[model samples]
Target: MDQAPLHVLAGALCDREGRVLLAERPAGKHLAGLWEFPGGKREPGETPLVALARELDEELGIALVEAAPLIRVPWRYHERALLLDAWCVTQWRGAPRSLEGQGLRWCLPMQADPATLAPADRAILQALRLPPHYLITPAEVLPAERDFWFERIGHAIEAGERMLQLRLPLWPRESVREFAASLLPLARAHAAQLLLNADIEGARVLGIGVHLTGAQLATLGERPLPLQQIVGASCHDAAQLAQALRLDVDFATLSPVAATASHPQAQPLGWSNFQELAEAAAMPVYALGGMVPAQLAQAQLAGAQGVAGIRGFWSAS
Candidate 1:
């Protein structure tokens, strides 16, 4: 595959009823007439959000008010590397019209057929069926702490944290399995879904969903997970984001919207740029990387389904 980097931004433009707008690429362009999230290419010295705002205004004649960070997918497309960032634009000026002359349509997955989208954007649509909010489980260490963890989890369940994950790094396999077995019941008892982080085998044995790391997303072979359960992935840029979407993952997390201690020096895409990415995504994107529950309103305004984190969300009880 070619490694040349292509930076692209897109949006999930929502109306009062939360329906997203999709646009068809005009004829004569690459992927001409292919449906895509409405946005454009990035220019040197222009941030992705700046490009999105400018593109939307020119193409649809609307002035965006609040756009938020959503999903960032980094993938290789047709031998060329692409970084697709998506944002959600909830507020804007003027009614949207297809000023560029491409067909525009509103999409709500429950009512629309998925086959119409460009082959590349199909995976994103599949992931959108998942619930907008997520509750990522805290990473724990001691096996003896199962009760301690479940106590807090039970409270979160009561408070409406319907999704959970088990992410204990490097614990013994037996202990992890035992812990997973223990948590699964509580999750089931409460009617919540439990997911395993990068542990498809564990999820299978435990009978739940799996959340893939960004690296594993590209390696998927025919989606081995059960069709009935959720499958999720972590994405950092457009390429990976698109891959997750293409794979029809149940949901995905994109991160480092702001710099975090986990990777102190990695270039962080702030919320403004995050909004641009979320807008273009066809899936429900969650805001991650240094986020807390209190920031959810701002995150939502920017186009995130919600926020996820290790530190910010672990103590919800």
Candidate 2:
């Protein structure tokens, strides 16, 4: 039997420099000594935003001014299930101090070690680190158009595309490896992360990350790479999404939110279905298939981490 999810509102109080405020659970409480985003359980009939505001005032002596939806984390902890509704509190009135006498720290997302955080808060940390747009390379890049594609990629990076996937399935292994090698420096120069699609060996050799196909994700029993390296997956349905979560993938892309020119025959999931699946996902999920940068806000409203696409992103101005 499934129990009703306990809705808890949490806020990532971000400073101007982009550090998030975390509070350590005090002694004699559940998960004591563990760090987590500061908030509390939602009172009946209270909205998540209202509950977050109340919690902040009570726990941190702060007034919530503005906040944006961050991520909704649904976690199962042995016998209990929780729905953590997180928001990025960008504008709050007072400086956050631990009014409850708990330890407080403000740190960059990457600096928030998972070992020191509550198990349920780990996914929120990952969500905070991920960018709002994911770019996927075309399936095949003609040799003659290589320079053109590179220029386009460079331009996109310059415009703040921080995460990318090179998915050249039809290219020779050696060719893909060489091309990825050449692109790594460019990606690094722009402070962007590049993931090799369905090429674990190449990714390992290149000291980069790998993006697993759905088939590869299903076959994996454990994480393929070290924790330091990013691992993402392409998931189409609930089963694949579960597998990616089980492997503890950094993120995953769920596709066909809208009909696509690339895969004309594939049916789109639509926003309603996308929301249903994404709400239950354990990790950050990017909405793919016929996606454009303009749809990012829409995707987020539908419980997605962001939007992902090939042509939509590559061709954007």
Candidate 3:
């Protein structure tokens, strides 16, 4: 029989500057010298929130005032299994200090390098940096419509869109590259990330990111881009999710969560099944297919980083 996982509750404590706190593991402890979110084991009979509060008090010397669910990570290190349940702690009674002898630092989520974080804590860092909605451009193959799409993309960026993918399968690669390059200034101006769908060269050339199809994901044995560039994948089942995790992908889109017009023949995973597959993934999972911006919170509660969709996410205008 498999051993039960240890329940751990962590807090992403934020300061007025919008920076989150990180703690370097003290010597003599497991995974010592690595940086991680400040938290500890969940003792029996204590709820996750209560456990987080107690851990924050013991480790950081703070009394939790307000915290919201961030993400729950299911991870394994060799034979050791643990569930890293974290919350976004916005308010606290006292200033957080390193009461447990661990070094503490506060930095912007995107500014913190994931490699410096403890293995499982990397996912927490990603959750803090990534947005709750990943918007995908619809299939539009036309030289005449290029400007139109750019206008729409610009609008979305101005509206606080952070993550987007250029998934124009029918368009030529060079044209797509040029379009992505043209938008880079706008994307950068607004701190948005523009990822190309299945275009590794374009992404690498532009120093952006790539989103791998399930087929491409199966073929690659390692991460295609450098650590600074983000990588996402399209995953439908537990096996694809495993492949994504194997590649150490930053995030994944678990699609067909609900029936839709584009893929009418494909069966839907439904929220329950989607939750199961999402839980199994070591990285963040986004519910694709039949998703809208309205369901972001529900998706997050269901173990998803958020929702990714083509139609509902973009505006008609």
Candidate 4:
């Protein structure tokens, strides 16, 4: 029989060099001596952010001011199951010390190879290496001519777009599937992952992933979807961020890092704020809203995996 999952809060704290902090579990504890993110179980009625903040204070002797939202990873370990809620907390006070007298290490995300990680944490590391950038195509009606959209998509693929979200809102489901069937081959031919935006059926039918909108993200609970494909959502604040992290989603997009016409009213988080958020995120974050390819380097500097754009990514050769 499958054991019910346990809910736990986890942290991805890091320093200036892009090196993350990992704590060695103390002897005699569950998974003791194994390396894991430094956080503890969530208390009853306590939120994940609050739980993470409190856990960081207790385990690392630091104050976590803010954390970027992240994907949740739910896994079952022998006797206990784990619903791992994770975040990247960039802004903190003081150097981290192992307050619990466990060992600690700072290593590059890739360097923390899965072979050395605890079973549950290995999945988290696989998520960390993903490039932060995503290219969002406008969801407006495609040209009446079938070849037109495909030609343009071909150009985008040649320009190094490894991931794409096909989002034509009014297109009928059959039409969407037809379009995906036509274009996905081109994408797969180019080594890209084509994600169907908010089209779960289309994605599943086409053997692709689905990108959840913020509203859908807010309503999600335990996920039993097929594990072979990626699952992601859009997030805008600590609460939504916490929810995404608790769901063990594969990735997520956080937007308006800077002001854009796409969302004029949404206040921009700016680079400094983005930096703070990236530091705490357990999953690779892509800077969306008013972002451009030029910002990719700066995004990496700020701890993001990359930047996502619509106009900026599509504008030019």
Best by TM-score: 3
Give residue 133's error in model 1 in angstroms: 3.8
Residue pairs that clash (backbone atoms under 3 angstroms), model 2: none
Report how far residue 222 has shifted in candidate 1, in Å.
2.8
- lDDT to native, each model: 0.73, 0.89, 0.90, 0.74
Which candidate leads the pack in lDDT? 3
- Global CA lDDT of candidate 2, please? 0.89
lDDT of 4 by residue, 48-83 (tens): 888898999999889898787444665666667677
Q: Candidate 4 local accuracy as lDDT?
A: 0.74
Global lDDT of model 3: 0.90
Per residue, candidate 1 scores C-alpha lDDT tens digits across 1-317 of: 54556777777787887588888878897778678778776878998889888889988898878887555555556777676676778888898898988889997743445556665454445444445457666555566677877787678777778776777775676676777777777677776777778888888887888889887988985565765667878888888877876777766688888888777987888888888777666566788888877888888788777787776677644
Error of 3 at 136 (Å): 0.8
TM-score of 1: 0.60
Q: In angstroms, give how far residue 190 of model 4 lies from its true place.
A: 2.9
Candidate 3's displacement at residue 134, Å, is: 1.0
Candidate with the larger lDDT of 1 and 3: 3
Q: 3 or 4, which is superior by lDDT?
A: 3
Ranking by TM-score: 3, 2, 4, 1
Cα RMSD (angstroms) for every candidate in the order listed: 7.6, 1.8, 1.2, 10.0
Give per-residue CA lDDT, model 3, range 230-270, as digits (tens): 99999989999998888888999998999988899989999
TM-score of 2: 0.93
